[model samples]
Every structure is written in C-alpha cells, then in structure tokens.
Target: MDPALLKAREAFKKKAFATPVIEAKRPVTSNQESGKESNKKPRKSAPAPVAEKTFDFKKYKPSSNANFACLAKIVKYMKQRYLDGDNEPLTLEDMLDETNQLDLAPRQRQWLATEALKNNPKVDITEDGQKYFYKPTFPLKDKKSLLRLLDKYDQRGQGGIPLEDIQESLPNADRCIKALGEAIIMLTRPTDKKKILYYNDRSIQFKVDDEFQKFWRTAAVDGLDDAKIEEYLEKHGITSMKDVGGKNSTPMQKRKKPTSKKPRNFKKHNEHMGDILQDYNG
Candidate 1:
C-alpha cells in the first residue's frame, strides 16, 4: 500500500475508535411528574362539577307515548318509595325496570337517563363516586303542601323562603306560583339576586290609590339615610315607631389607666457598641 493510503487508513481507524458523542437521554417521567418538571408548578386538580339549579324544559320535546313519560313515572315511583321509608338511591336500570320502561330503545333510554330523569324537578339525583342514583326531591307531593310551607314561613316572620327551596320541594313550582297570582310576592335578593317567595295575605292587602302609589314611587329617597329621613319626617309632624321608642345612647368606652411602663432606662450608648465596631474592623 502507498504511504498516503496507509496514513488515510490510520486516520479512519482513529476516527472510528474516537469517543461517540451520544446525546444524553432524559429519564422518562409520569404525566404528573413531567408537568411539575416542565413548569415548576404543582398541577391543579380539575374543579368538581357544580350541580345545575334549573333545567330548561324547552330543550326537550314534549313527553309522549314514545318515552312513556319515563321521567314523571320515575318521579312518582321514587316519591312513593320515599314515603314508604325506602329512601335508598335507585339506579337508572332499577328506576326503568320499576316504571315498566325497560323496553325503551337504546337512544330513548340514554335520553331518559341523561335528560329526562336527571332534569326532572321532582327527582333528586346524586352520584356516589361509583354510579349515579335517584331519589325524590322532597316528601311533600302537591302544590297545596308547598303553599302551606310558604304560609308557615310567612307566619313565623322569617323573611321569605328561597324560590330554589320551593322549586326543590314542589314539582310544578312555576305553574303553582303562576296560579297563585298576587297571592305570592316574589322578590329578587340584592346580594345573590336569587328569587325569594313571600306569601301574601289578601286580608291585609288594602287597595291604595294609583295616584298615591305613583307619588310613593316617584319620591326619590336615594341619598337620604334612615336617620335623616326620620328627622325630616319628625319635623313634618310624622313620627315612626323607631322614633316613638326613643334613640339609644352609644355606650362609652372606659379609658385605660396609663400603664406604668418602667421608663426604658436610656443607656448613654448601645451595650454591644464595642463588639459591633470590632466585628466591622475585623
């Protein structure tokens, strides 16, 4: 072999024997570990799903023989079971079987479970980490009982019962409230804006002149506080129950006697001054 060929072969051998530049492989980690490694932030667990307060009935078509009013039948069955002291959570299959709805088609069954039964106002559904189950919303079955509850709350002077509570108790709460007409006063709470239902006593509901109502509504008391309003009313020969009871005096706070704090003996200089100077010098 030529000298040049020999030198080339030696160079090739040297190159082949040289240390291989292998890229360092990062150790594999789990999804949770990888998330922490990448962002240096602990992964936030998903928020638990909140239950819906209301269901839109318009989204579903009217119940017919097709679905066999599966939801209504189930509600009735559950309520009966509840009254009989059997308040155990019933499965969809169990509800369907009980309500003679096992013969429903797959799509219809799915609809009944996901939409109909779950959205029924009379049904109280819950999931126990394993499977979803159903129960009755409340023990009271009729609008009369709901009205009685409202009357009881009103009589007790506990402000007004929550509309959500009424809805949860009564199956046809909207219809019942509508049928009640002016017999119920529905007011929206200022804080959360949730509707509150107050029972109206027709015996005490005296008719007021339209002009007086207009005057009352047009009167702007927006900037006036209760005290200012009361003062103004008193000046005009109008006295409120609050004024008749007399004003309450503010309780005076007792002044604490000067605590004899031992006069912080003023040292002419800091005790550690020499030590501090020595440390700085060193």
Candidate 2:
C-alpha cells in the first residue's frame, strides 16, 4: 500500500474550504402589497343552468260545446222553416245546407245530425229507412195550438209551463212571448236558470211597486242551508214559530194470507211390472 499518498490525501482534506453564509430577505412594503392586490381581479361565479321545456302529447277529445252550438244554429234554422210554413222534417244534408253549416267536416256533420240532435231535448230526430230527419220538438204545428195548450194548463191550475218547451214548439217564440207580455209572467228558476212562463190572472193579480219587489227579492236567504238560515234568522231577532202537537198517523198492519193444503199422495194399483202383468192377465 502507498502510505505516503494516503497521508497526503488526509492532509488535503484537513485544509478544506470554509462554509458559505445565506443572505437575509428584505421586508415587503404596503404600496407593493396594494399594487399586487389591485392587479388581481375577483373571480365571477358561474351562472345557474336553465330547465328545458317539455311538450304535452295527451290526446284531445271532441267537445260537446261545439256540438251544442251547431245544434242551436240548426234549431234556429228549423224555427225559420216552421215560420215559412214548412212542417215537414228536414234531412241532415238539407239542414246543413239551409243553416250554412255545410263547411263542417264530414265526421262532425254526421255526429251533429245523429247523436247531438237525438240527445237534445229541443230537437226531435226520426229515421226514414236509410237516413235521419231532424225537427224541433213541436207537439203542435202553430202558435194558436200552443196558446190553446197554455190556456189548458191555466184552466187545470197546473203551476206553470217551461218557456223552453214553448220555444222549442213554436216559431218566432220571442215574438209570441213579447205579444203575451202582460198576459204571462216570465220567471227564471234559480236552480237551473230555466225560464218559466206562468199565466198571469189579471183578476187575481194586483200591481206591486218595483222598489218593494226589489227589496223583497234582495232579502232572500240565498246560499244558506236550513240550519244556517235558522241561525241567521235567530241572530237577526227573528225566529220561526214551533209547530203545535198533532195526532200521529197509525201505521197499517200487513195482512197474512191463509195457508193452502198440499195435495194428498194416492197409492197406484199397479206400481210394479209384476203387478201390472197380473192385472193384464185378470
């Protein structure tokens, strides 16, 4: 081994270079910090997503309102025909042409003439072998006959007749009603909004003031049930008088029918084949 070279390397290591010193950092100024903040802008948030609209694909049905409207037009046409002295029932095509409703779709026209007219109370539909004919529900042919019927109703003391019936029966019904202004009382029923024609008996009727009539009508306890009405009346210092005791009706007893006797069973002289053979031999 070379001892001299090893000793020389150890001596070189012992005379090594001195350690390097680190430099201190300078402090940041307020102006530099403000400048840095000003250079950087605030980030914006992303916008919310919008919902997509969907279409409704439900199947639509044919409305009865359109059918009734068409039926009304046809009825008006029928009334006009009756006025023109045509008592005969009109065919489907004839009615459509006369009412200027020929432009309606074939299916709609067919439905209007058949089902709509048949179901309507104001219309009378009749079939002639292959095709249908439509007419107003007229029990009588003329205005005179309608007046006679009304007079009959008045004589019978039957409360009143429906004006709708007369309208459906007679032509120029409005004119007839107007002509009978003083002779009849036209009333509207609250339940169904139906117009009723009451025969005004001049002998029994006396004129009442319009103001008094209005007051009476406005004082009605509308939209109240019987219990609520009673409560309201009592609250307003008005109470209905209690009913007095009356004799109660006795319930009738059901009568029983007498029992029928059953028929007696008689013995047969020759019930078996051997007995029948002996009888034959005798």
Candidate 3:
C-alpha cells in the first residue's frame, strides 16, 4: 500500500475509536428542590364555582287568565308587591307572570320585556345590560338621574320623599309632579302612617278617599301655582294630606262655608213709596 493510503487508514481507525463525552449535570440540593417546587407553582387548584339562585316557579307564578287594566296597572301591582313588605328583588318573570309561562328563560324574559313592555309610557320598565328594573314615571326624561335623588328601603320607583325634601332635591319637583298629574301624586303610604308623595301610584295608598281625590282634582283644575295651591289647600282645611286616614280616621275635607239668606228687594213698611217718588223726581 502507498504511504498516503496507509496514513488515511490509520486516521480512519483513530477517528472511529474516538468517542465524544457530555458533561454530567449536578444533582439538586434540598433548597434547590424547594425552589423547583415553588417555580412549578403547584398546578393552580381550580376556583370553586358560585351557585346561581334559581327562580321559584310553583310558588311565585302569576295568575293565568288575569287581565291588568293597562301597563300602568301592571306596574302598580308590581310596585305594591314590593311596598307590601314582600319587597323581594323584582324580575321580569314576576312582571309578566300574567303570561302563565313557568319555564321562561332569561333570553325569553329579555325578549318579552323589549317587545311587550319597552315602548309603553304608562309604565317605566327599564333594562341595564341583562338586568331588568322597574323605574317609576318621572315628569322629566332623565328618570334614572332624578331617581338617584330618592332613598329606597325596598324598591324605589315610588316617592317616599316629603314635599319640602323633594323641593330641596329638585327645585321644580312640585311643578314637575303636578305636570305629570296622576302619574305621580301625594298619597298615604302602604303603612298609612304618613302622607308621602309617590310617583306612578305605586303604593297601596292608591285607594284614594273622596276628600283626597277631591283635593287633587281641585288642584289640577285650579292650575299649578303656589298661590293657588296654598289657597286651595287652605280652603280644604288640609294642613297636610299625609296619614290621611291614620288610626281609622276619615280623610280631610274642606271647611264648610257659613250659610245666610239674602234680604228681599221689597220696600220698608213706612214711607218707602213716597221716598222713592221724591228721589226719582229729584
């Protein structure tokens, strides 16, 4: 064999015998093991799921064939349910319980509210995101902002505010309520302890008495003016319409006017004819 061939063969044998070596890594220490575990972050235990409150259909389902007089009437009923001290949070299901459908889904309630109740002015049914709320009728268009001025124990559609308090909240609140008329009125509350101004006839005090109704009718007819309202209120002997029938008392009525007969046009017994003749001649 040639020298170059012999040299090549020797190189191939040496290259084949040569093996590559990899460096061995160091073993973890106790502290390093703890660090590893901490770094691994213990597969994050999944969060416990929250349970949703289920609606009670059998107990709370509305009347099947009942006909509400109007949307206002329906709102009135719903508001009374709240004010009656049964004041659970309202759901569209309760409002449309008139439909008699037990298996109403959330989306279905939304659709029903949008389609059936949204446009009606008699009642103020409102939706925020997916939640539905019953807003009271306000004379002003911004019901939400104006309503924020109120304090609610149960639900707040009706006004529990006093006249002076309301006046403080809104300068024209009286005029606004007057312009709104029966939409919001002064009435005894469900408790009947006080006469508070309410919006949309939401309280059980809705059953206005003869004198109470007469005052409002008279006020509306007399027109919306402080002077007229004061005079009319005074004429009715009504210091305050609040607690109108408290403790089984009759509602306030106007003070009776004194009666007296007018004098006759006939002449006096003596000298009347002669005096009249002389005066006519003069």
The candidate that achieves the highest TM-score relative to the unseen native structure: 2
lDDT, residue 198, model 2: 76
Residue 213 of model 1, lDDT score = 97
Give the alpha carbon lDDT tens digit for every residue of 157-177 in model 1: 877888876665566678878
C-alpha RMSD of each candidate structure in angstroms:
31.3, 19.3, 29.2
Q: Residue-wise lDDT of candidate 3 within 55-112, one digit each (tens)?
A: 7644553333332233444565654543333433445656557434545545444444
Deviation (Å) of 180 in candidate 1: 3.8
In model 1, what lDDT does residue 241 have? 45
Clashes of 1: 0
Model 2 regions more than 4 Å off: 1-71, 127-138, 141-144, 154-157, 174-195, 200-282
Per-model TM against the reference: 0.38, 0.40, 0.21
Better of 1 and 3 by lDDT: 1
Q: Model 2, 282: alpha-carbon shift in Å?
A: 38
lDDT for position 60 in model 2: 32
